[model samples]
Target chain A: MFGFCADPDTLGNVAWMACYLTTGKHMAIYLSVGTVLLLLAITAPAALAFGFAGASAARSRILPLSWLGRGYIAVVRGVPDIAFFLFFVIALDQFFEWIRHEVKCPDWDQPIRQGNDFVVCAEAKLPLGNAAQWVHETYGFFLAVLTFAIVFGAFAANVLYGAMRAVPRAQMETAEAYGMSPRQCYWRILVPQMWVYALPGLSNLWMVLIKATPLLFLLGVEDIVYWARELGGAKTARFTDYPHGDWRMWYFLALLVFYLLFTRVSEIVLDRIMKRLTHGQATSGGEAQRKAA
Target chain B: MSCLQTIADYGLRSIGIGERLLPREDFTLCQQFTLIGSGMIWNVYFGLIALLTGFFLATAVALGKASSNPLARKPSEWFIFVFRGSPLFIQFFFAYFAFLSLKSVSPIFDPFTSAWLGAAIVLFLNTAAYSGEIFYGALLSIPKGDTEAADAYGFSGLTKFRKITWPTMLRLAWPAYTNEAIFLFHATTLVYFSGFPAWRQKGDALYYANYFADKTFNPFVPYPILAGYFILVTLVIITVFGLVNRRLNRHLPQESRGRLKMRMNLIR
Candidate 1:
């Protein structure tokens, strides 16, 4: 923020506008975009890891693990994901606190669920009772990211599970014939080949993820959507040096444009990645390229 | 209260018909199931109406996009891109705010600020754009030979489209369109969560589910019940669409008819 923001009322139109935009709240709003991106950066990989575990679990020879994995994927499929987003975050938080309360408060005799309230000892609190503001925010954000990863991990698992199967049965058999262990067959043949198949779904999941970042606001994070509503609401003449009518429409328009551009760029990048993955592969895309060459 | 008594009081609670005040304490499993199930009426209302209306408009949009005239093509194309490109969550907020802004200029737009009309309109447009693209893709893939055969005959323009192109487009787009319908149902859950406040707590299934989650601080019960209801609805949708799909492909030979396999592709 430029320091010339002292007398917003006395300043000219362009100067006043500049100063108004440089307000502390506006700066926080600007940084919220970074928060959105940071979430995407962290959640994408986390979700991928969860998906990999899930896919691997589903494919496991062991019965319970496969059932767990398949159930994870199938159950998540039927419900609205927004329901899961709202449900899992609270459920997980409570489950964690209940565990912590049990560990820390063995002597306490009071029931944890007293009527409508979920009460716990002070130490059982997620970030501790006297934690810093940043810690609470971080904890909430962490829960949100976890929720996103879990919901989307199911989707990604669906994609990856299919992609894993899409790798021909022949390829795995050939790996076994060549004296490779099942693990070797998986790692060497299936894993590498699954990428091209997974790319389309993964890329789609990425777009859905990017679009879903707005839902962080629902989870009580000060995400871009939250800030847009906060900053864009009408400021009374008594409230600030700068008075503005309701500008939520404009704020939301900016968000729409931001998402549009993000998805457009992602599409271009994913298209390029697809081309590279398809090169010399047996798919029709690769066949066309081979014919052209 | 007995379970039957509780159901009697709260059965139509979601539509503002019964139980003016929601149950605050001593929640029963039966009460949870009854109220949430009642709330599903709104979900069905929003989804069915949106899909029903969007289906007709989507065909127009698909035809518009396929038209050689840029005048007709551009708007439909842009409509598809904007709606299909953005998240439905943001679209809901943006639409609600946009409707609010329009209210002062004309009283005609007043009802749009309400959740029922406004949210339904957004869902309608969203599904339209999604199904439009699906229809457009199907239009593009319509075999040239069929069109040529029509051309070779006296069939042209309206007659050509009515007799030949329309059936083919519907047949091709049916599978993707079915997925879009399911996705729309999933999307109706976001309506209450977005900027639109549920008028007097007359809300969708997820709204009531969220209410129970808040009250009891136990998510395990209400959410799963809601999911069960949704899965039941989804199964019904699949069956209904499968029948329609069969009808669409009825003219084709048995071997050539398309199989109605369900794929959970997120449409629009």
Candidate 2:
């Protein structure tokens, strides 16, 4: 990152530290934070959309749709999420490649699963085996995002479903008496009012999502956890210019501090948002606001 | 080999009891199921013990947090804040490395560096913090009239807590605690992935699943088998906790008693 970063061994104390921190691997570590943020930015809305559909389906009058939604929520809740993460990434990947194999290799009739191997054709390979490094990285990241969205979506669905139910029956009845259609009342009144109730649960979920980002390393993504483990292992003089003893403890300590700071900032922002959202509702926070004014 | 024979050879593989070497080639479905099922023992061990132990500690910590005394309250508050503020993944890594460092400084501490202790300690602490928050919420929501009634009858401190506060907290927190137990079981999959090395192939469910996935380059079988085992364990947890919850709230009037509703919103 700086001109003095060249010849790390020759550099003095502060300079060596600067160069040490600016190594190519360190750059990757910094980039992984961006990856974590990018994941949050993408997964939050995707999961919200999934949650919205799920909540709507769960509330549906149709029995089968409600069952499907209920089952989706139940299955995810019943299993450990890490199990789903490990399962879905592989399962989804195979499902995608299997579909592609059927489409791209119509002439090749041998089983896609021969004995123990999952041999998809060259064209059917996700990101293709010969593709650039960036494509592979992106593909892995995309899978992680999808996995996160699926797991957190179940959680968000539970929250939103509760929030929907918590919307007072009298409010809906009033809307109904005012000549509003069921759909119109749902959109104009219930949806708008439910968010104040949802905000607290959603804020909690956001903190959880932040904490879960570290699991990206387990999905084969070169995330911060991966970088910390890679860079902080004992590096002998033979292996690299900057010889260091076991520093994984320090690296992970840094990660711990990073996460604590991240969660703290999130708490502050979410609290502000909660206060704003509760400004004029019938909830306790809303009533407190009115009394204080 | 027959499935029974395969089970006999590898059913205790995760604990290094029967199989010395894992099947490298010619992996079969039966082997995957047997070995992965064996690995589930560790997951169950980690989840069950942690949840059981964490329950009492969580109750105590929650009570401490709700106490008027700053000496008791402050430590409990800080404990929850530290554990809840950081990611469990980082906690595992930090703890494993910290244990490793301790082992070097004192050879007597080497046994403590093992996964069974190190991972359990972290999970215990992590779950305690999470369930502490839930119990604290439940404690706060306990009806004032119940406490007043206890006071009117000369029930105070320990007696009051035993009669009123404890049961009410357990009843209110049961649903949330059930969710916490489920997530902790899920978190057991993370033990091997963190800094704790799976010595002698003695690892948890996801560990063996990953091993099979790597050897076969096919994740379709082993991972799902692990998931199945976990789903079964989760159901068992819900059933057991639900029964306990029923027992806790058994004395209350039917209309007055709050039902044990599973809310899956909170994650720790």
Which one is best on TM-score? 1
Q: Each candidate's lDDT (Cα)? A: 0.90, 0.88
lDDT of 1 by residue, B78-183 (tens): 9988987888888888999999999978999999998889999999998999899999999999999989999999899899989999999999989888888888
The prediction achieving the highest DockQ against the true structure is 1
Candidate 2 DockQ vs. native: 0.63
The 10-residue segment of model 1 chain A with minimum total lDDT is A1-10
At residue B247, candidate 2 shows an lDDT of 90
Candidate 2 whole-model C-alpha lDDT, 0 to 1 = 0.88
Highest lDDT model number: 1
Query: Which pairs of residues collide in candidate 2?
Result: none
Q: What is the C-alpha lDDT profile of model 2 across A55-170, one tens digit per residue? A: 98999999999998988888787666776787788888999998999999999878888876888889999989889999998999899999999999998898899899999999
